[model samples]
Target: MLELNFIRANKSRVIQGLKIKNFSEEDLQIVEEILSLDDTRKEVQTELDSLLAERNQLSKTIGDLMKAGKRAEAESQRERVGQLKEQAAKLEDSLKDTKVQLEELLLKVPNIPHESVPPGATPEDNEVYKAWASPLPELSSDALPHWELAQKYNIFDLELGVKLTGSGFPVYRGKGAKLERALISFFLDEATRAGFEEVIPPLMVNEDTARATGQLPDKEGQMYYVERDNLYLIPTAEVPVTNIYRDVILDAADFPVKMTAYTPCFRREAGSYGAHVRGLNRVHQFDKVEIVVLQHPDKSYETLQEMLAHVSGLLDKLELPYRILRLCGGDMSFTSALTFDFEVFSAAQKRWLEVSSVSNFETYQSNRMKLRFRDGKATRLAHTLNGSALALARVVAALLENNQTPEGIVIPKVLRDYTGFELLN
Candidate 1:
């Protein structure tokens, strides 16, 4: 959430930013409505304060009158105080309602794009930030997609997954299962070596945790809810991992805090279907290793770059052809001030599949989470960032499709030690 004062003082800039994000007229109206509601709340609070002050003064006057033996006058004064108390209560209720309305309106607003963000309304407008310099591999005409290759090698079972759970949840077997485990271990090891402490966060979080991370009141439908317990199945490790510092106030010495976690993310992927969702292209459950950081506000962008390089290094090791995109205003997440998506080229599929996204929330999340840092006597919001070191399913798809041979699917050299084999056959 944006600082209410910032939004109020910069309405024009906020509107322009929202326009670049392709917000509809109805959505833009909420922006103005929030300001109006905030004004009303201020007015009500002022009146309540005045009433409270008057009541306090009246109480003193009533005591004085009683001591003077002016019983009738004191009794009349008591009636006036009672009236003021009722009015103050009503105004307090109004203030509470207005705050709720204002918060709901603000929640609908996406984070204002950074000045460097391009003005665009879709992924097509996102600029390519970097690209692999090496030539992409050419595959033979007989090259099969990951799904077909999975069947040939007995590495994964989709029908078995359907029988066990449902579509959009594939069961990995033999080499495929081993490859998945190897990738997770490799990612965690890489993150730890880079000074990130590894953690095992809970898979389910409460409503407050979801809301603190900006996942609730917006993306609720995209998550699996445990209604009886009022818990949400985490969509990404970022939620729980970043929330680790929620409501914390750190000293200046804690300028940079980094943590990584491997988790099986669960998502509803509601309204998704068709060919693009086939095989490992899209799934309801997938394993991923995520890196989250909390940094002093001034150092956040630097930290973001470091995270980007870390993910890029992983891709370089895997030898997957990939590109990074600076997300346009419309393509960025609601909580991110800036985001970069990394896409790995799947040669056989002839498409770029996103394997990672690194973002700097720049206090957008910290404000909601109440995460702050103290510098001597002053305190301010900290900046939060997180990235998928790599999401396994799609990365696996790219590997199987791009490196397939007439004999078998060759594992990336970096992963050979982890998998304990050169090929998956």
Candidate 2:
């Protein structure tokens, strides 16, 4: 959440930022309403405090008057105190209502877009940050899509997946399964080598963890629920991995903490369809390696670029054609101030598929999680960031689709050692 004080002080700037993000003018008005409500709340609390102070002084005066045997004066002071108490109670109620108003409005507001963000409404408006390695490979019109190639190689069984679970879940067999495992291992190793501590986070997280990652209140419908236990099957490793720092207060020495985790994530995909859901593009359950970082507020944006570079390096190693896109405000997540999506070209499909998203949430998650650090001077909120080093399913899908030669599927040179094979027939 954006700081209430910052929202109050920078209302105009925030509104303009939202406009760049394509938020309606009505949302701008709602922000103004929150500031107005905050002012009213402060006024009511001030009045109640003043009334309480007056009552206390009068109570002492009544005691003194009673001791002096001035019964009439004591009686009058008692009546004044009673009236003050009644007024204070009413003020307290008004203050409570104003606070509720402020909270409701604040929840509806979106984060201010960074000045660097392009003014646009959708992904089509996003500017490509950069491309990795070289130009994309050419695909013939008859190139088999990943799903078709999966069937030809006997690697993925969508029919079996649907029988066991649902449509979005696909079962992997033989080399495909091993390849998935290898991808997970390779991603974890590469991230660990880059100073990230690897962790195996729980697949199911409690309500608190979901809220810490900004998935509960607004995105509850998009995740699977263990109804009996009231736990949410994690939608991403970001939920469990990042929440580890929830409610923590670190020293300045712990300025930039980096961690990575590999986990199977579950998503509901309640209402999704068409070509976008083909193959590994959208799945109910998928494996992914994620990197989360907590950095000093001053160093957050820089850390975000560092993460981008790390992901770009992996793409380069794999020799995949990919592009980095700056997500526009309308396309940005509720918790992220900024986001960069990584897309890999699928030659067989002749399209680009999203493989990862690296986001700098700034203090949005930290504020909700109460993750702070003591800087000796003040307790400041830490900047939080997370990115998929690579989501295994989509990466494999892209690899399979792109590496399809008439002979076999040639594995990327970097992953060959991990997979223990040069090609899959």
Candidate 3:
């Protein structure tokens, strides 16, 4: 959530940023409503404080009157204090209501884009930050898309998943299962080697954790909720891993807190359907290894670059052709101040599949989580960053498509030791 004070002080700038984000007229109106409610909150709180102060002063006078044996005067003062107390109570209720309204409106507002973020209304305008110099793989018509390859190899079972659960859920069998496990282990090992502490977080999180990570309100429809348990099935490990620091206060010396977790992510993916959504390209449940950092605001961007390089190194080791995109304002997420998407070129699919999104939320998430660090005598919201070290499904899709041969699917040399096999055929 944006700080109310910042919004109040930089209303015009905030509005301009929202416009760049492609906020609709109704969305912009929410901002105005928040400001109006804030104004009412301030007025109501001031009146409540005045009434309470008067009530306190009257009580003191009533005590004095009673001590002086002026029963009548004491009763009169008590009556006046009671009236003030009533007024204060009503004002307090009004203040609470106003605050709730303001907060709800604030949640509707997205994080302002960083100054470096380009202005655009869609992914088409996103800038290509980097592209591999190697030529994209050109495959013959004989090459099969990943789904066809999956059936040919008997690796993953979609029909079995449908029988067991529903569509969008897939079951990996034999080499496919091994490949998934190997990728998870590889990602976790890489993140650990990069100085991130490994964590095993809960698969389901309560409302607070989800909201703190900016997954709630905006992503409610996309999440799988357990009505009986009142817990949300986590869409990513980022939610639980980052929420570990909610309401936590750290010392300045804890400048960069790095953590990583691997989890089976669940998303409803409501209303999603198309040819591109086939096979491992998009799914309801998938495995992902996430990396998260809590850093000093001043150094968060530098930390972001370091993280970007870490992910880049992983792609290089796998020898996959990839590109990096600096997402434009409108293409960025509600919680991201700036984001870089890493897409791997799937040869047979003849398209780029996004496998990672590294983002610096600045103080957007920390502010909501109350994750602050004390800088000498002052405390401030720490900048939060998270990225998919890699989302497994798309990575799997790209790997199978890029490495497929008429004879067999070749495994990358780096994962050989983990998978203990060179081919998935």
Index of the highest-TM-score prediction: 3
RMSD of each: 2.3, 3.2, 1.8
Better of 1 and 2 by lDDT: 1
Across 1-425, the per-residue lDDT of candidate 3 in tens digits comes to 99898888999889988988998777788777888888888888888888888888888888898899999989888878878878888888888888888888899899999888998989999999998788899998899999999999988988899999999899999999999999999999999999999999999999999999999899999999999999999999999999999999999898799999999999898887899899988999999999999999999999999999999999999989999999999899999999999999999989999999999999999999999999888899999999999999999999999999877889999999999999888
Per-prediction TM-score to the true structure, in the order listed: 0.94, 0.90, 0.95
Name the weakest run of 10 consecutive residues (lDDT summed) in model 1: 270-279
Better of 1 and 3 by lDDT: 3
lDDT of each: 0.92, 0.87, 0.92
Q: What lDDT tens digits, residue by residue, belong to model 2 across residues 1-425?
A: 77788887887898898788777777568777877788788888888888988998999999999999999989988988889988888888888888877766766766677777887877788888886557678877777888998999988888899999889888999889878888888899999899999999899999999987789777999998989999999999999999999999999789789999999989898878888788888889999999999999889899999999999898888878899999877788877888999999988777888999999888888888899999888898899999999888888888888888888788898888898998998
In angstroms, what RMSD does candidate 2 have relative to the true structure?
3.2
Over 4 Å off, model 1: 24-27, 56-78
Worst 10 residues of 2 by lDDT: 103-112
Model 1 TM-score (2 dp): 0.94
Against the true structure, whose lDDT is highest? 3
Cα lDDT tens digits, model 1, 48-130, are: 99999999999999999999999999999999999999999999999899998888888888888887788788899999999
Error of 1 at 70 (Å): 10
The pairs that clash in candidate 3 are none
